[model samples]
Target chain A: MKKISKASLSKSFWRWWYGNLTCFTHEHMQTFGYMWSMLPIIQELYPTKEEQAEKLRTYYPFFNTEPQIGCIVVGITAGLEEARANGAEGIDDEMINGIRAGLMGPLAGIGDSLIVGTYIPVLLGIALGLSEGGSVLGPIFYIIVWNITSIWFQKFIYDKGYELGGNAVEMIVGEQAMAFRESIIVLGRIIVGAMAGSWVSINTSVILTYGLDPETGDKIPVFLQEKLDGAFPGVLTMVFVLLCWWLMSKKKVSPVKVMLLMVILAFVGVLIGFFDPGLSY
Target chain B: MSISWLQAGLLGFMSVLAASTPAALGTTVGNYTLNRPLVASLFVGLILGDVPGAITIAIPMQIIYIALVTPGGTVAADLRAVSYIGIPLAYVTCVSQGLDLAGAEAQGIAGALGALVGTVGTVMFYGTAMMNLFWQHYGWARLDKGDFNVLTKVEVFLPIVTHIVISFIPVTILVYYGAGAVENFKSALPMEAWYMKALFTLGSLLPAVGIAILLKSVINKTTDLIYFVGGFALAKSLGLSLLAATAIGGMFAFVNFQIAMASYKGASSGADDEEDI
Candidate 1:
């Protein structure tokens, strides 16, 4: 009974960790990186050069996902490769490829929403606050905190995938995991809203009319921003964010096009005295 | 505020390591870490000898790209260009224009510059990915001959060449020369210029698009927007800090999780009881 050495497993993990998207191409995506990662495992199991090459070719199929969380898929395949080398029943190229294909889509959704959409923004929101007045504490906090947690989480899932093998899919997609994911998404949405309120600043320069100062006989102009804020704080900003969301989600506008549209809006608003930054040399 | 060639070269190297598709230092350390505007601000600050100034400039850019998620490798904006090329140029512009880094005007300029550079970075992202096809094809040919060593070469080393061509040179040129061009432009057009007003106005409005892109990602149903509006009210109306809002949001999430799990248990137990009968 041949087994993959501990040295080879560690090498495989690190290889995948660093090389997942290194040689990425539009055609093959993560195919080369996946193959490179499996090299150590195939080499250890097959022994002969030609046999190793043949085994390595199994991962040559296209593979791409959120690379950090996609570490688990590599770990599962490593376990499958070990099992196939030991002549396990019903474990073939088709079965392994099937598992890989099946996991990529769901995992991408989870990774994108949880890690990218929610977690990073929350961390950045706090960091942006800390960065008040250009403090180094913010970036330093994010870099240290993000790297440690991300690497730890990736490594944790990788080990779990290896230990449980095919059963790992149940752990990720099970009812308990679904509850956990939903709650996290809830948290994500709330933080996104707070981020909108805190960061995005959209104001109107349009004034309804000018009020004269009766006591000093001076022209006292009433500011539109103050009036709007008195009615609802940052209502204009919220409206603009909602408008952008509506245009993108409902009207199917690309972000770049929407940005160009904002340019036009700003230009027209400026021309009509509806928007002004009030800058001078 | 002008970038020296050496500093530009360093920034260029960072961009090589930070490219999205073919990040030389890998995704975690490269794309997610160095490519982020907040993190890149620290490095740019260190390199340019202006920590406070750089961080101040990067704040608005960071907010604009706070939720830049690249699902299926399609990106709205590339952070390498935003962080490296855009920040440096914006820094020079702010310094030349004598705008306070903390003011809305500076922040607006930074946002506008970052968005413009981000598009350019997207083109370079595709270029780097396409060029790496040559090395991948070569590796495939060698692997057909049962050469295992070629995998390491193609995966790790050959991509560096692609980065040098696609990411490194362009960033170096842009940052190094863009500083002088910005100064010239600042001299030509005062802040009172019509185009400048439009530019800053555009800057203040652009982050809405970033926030909207983020909303599109997390808001699956119409009801999800209620949670968003709730958070907005918490921050805007109540004047709560982000940490305070997060604490409140976390409590809601916990309650939601408890309800979900309790229902899950109830459904399973009901099924079990029916089976027993």
Candidate 2:
């Protein structure tokens, strides 16, 4: 191969248009299945050349490859396949790693959410419901979702990864990506807020102090309750929110660790009468 | 081992995720790619004799996949845990048992652990795989960086074998046994198992917190809160189904996209005005 000068190397890989995303998916979803998810490139990898080119040029100045890490793997995978088919030479680690850098992000989104976000929850839900586990469906739902998505996407994406990758960027901002991005961003906000609201509305009980009807002989922690009432009106959920915020901001704990800690806390609370159902700990 | 079919499936998916890093070095050319939630779900179905459930979860996942990405050295999705942990959960909830994964309790612990494991596992796997690739590509390996030559062959091939096996074995076994362990655990529980059930029930609540955490960095503004709250409130006050919630969320996401795109265009226009100036 002739040595191409770094300067001559175009930031925009205009050639990536013809490549197939399935190639990356097959190797990634079928074989290995690790870091990257489909989020980075799913919407990004379009059906046409112009779209692919448009994606590239957008990220061209920043040196950000369109497919990011996961899709980059798609590129390098195609490169290796090309080399192998030609019988000229084999692939190398650097280029492969380069692909890794690009594809990891795309893969991570799907990976984290599906496995962590959706699958793990499904699995744990089963485990939580049943003693050792729930019914057989617990594991089954999770297993099926993961494999089907992984395999299907890989096969589907690879066949068109490069073809899609090659020039979608040139297509510029289109209706599809625009619509998609808008939806996700909005959905993300709503989901986050609702979840946050749940956190603020779980268990809210205030201890009574001085303010109350003397004849009724009922004391009210009206102050605290009043304060909470302005918000979600639940003490437990509020505490959960505070705890999450604190751990996340002040303690600098990882969310996973926090989750684990919460489980432990819940377990201990269950035994210690802290998670009392009537009172809503 | 004689693991049950579903357990075996979970194990299989887990193994796939665990092993992806090392395996990808040789197989996928060191991209360390993973998107395993569907894999585990499918394997569980195969084990339990039900592919339909797998398809259901996988398809939704695919459509929503527009949100995924893995950008340069950073993890976009974190598949390792998703597959190892996520698929098994689906199998447990969807196949063997009849609980919906959306609101299952056990998923809380299982989900967090699965994700945590995948992320951490990827870190170590990447480090090891990267180092091995380095040694093979350089050092005594005498591998040529020159792309497609003779000496580079041996150096290139050796690390992948080791890589693939390293990742594949442990996770597979973990997933394999994990599901069965949960099953066996249910049979042995006393009346107290109900309490365990309650705790697990609480586990369902964990995901919302997780959602909060997941969106923490992703959502950093009040308007974002409005968008989220709008959809969330619709579902909650109206008691809408998750599917409906997802739909509303999708619509809001579309609005968000429009606003963001407009801003991006504004920035571009500003650039043009600067050029004119």
Worst 10 residues of 2 chain A by lDDT: A30-39
- Write down the worst ten-residue block by lDDT for model 1 chain B: B268-277
Q: In model 1, which residue pairs have backbone atoms overlapping below 3 Å?
A: none
Instruction: Please list the residue runs of candidate 2 whose C-alpha ends up more than 4 Å from where it truly belongs after superposition.
Output: A1-184, A191-246, A249-252, A276-281, B1-14, B17-39, B48-160, B171-202, B246-277
Cα-based TM-score, every candidate = 0.95, 0.50
- Over the stretch A1-281, how does candidate 1's per-residue lDDT look in tens digits? 77888898888888888999998887988888888888888988997887886787789789998888999999899888888899989988888999999999889888888888788888887788788899999998998888899999988888777777787878777888888889988888888888888888888877778888889888877889999999988989989999999998889888878888998998898889888888765
Q: Which candidate wins on TM-score?
A: 1
Judge candidate 2 against the unseen true structure and give its global Cα lDDT, from 0 to 1.
0.40
Candidate 2, residues A1-281, lDDT tens digits: the string is 32222221111121122111111221122111211121123113333545433332222111223232233345334433334323444334444444444455445553443333433333333322221222345344444454455445444444444443333222213444444544554565555444444322343223445677779878745645456555633434535644664576456676556656766776666665444333110
What are the per-residue Cα lDDT tens digits for candidate 1 across B212-252?
88888888887889999998989999989988999999999
lDDT of 2 at A97: 45
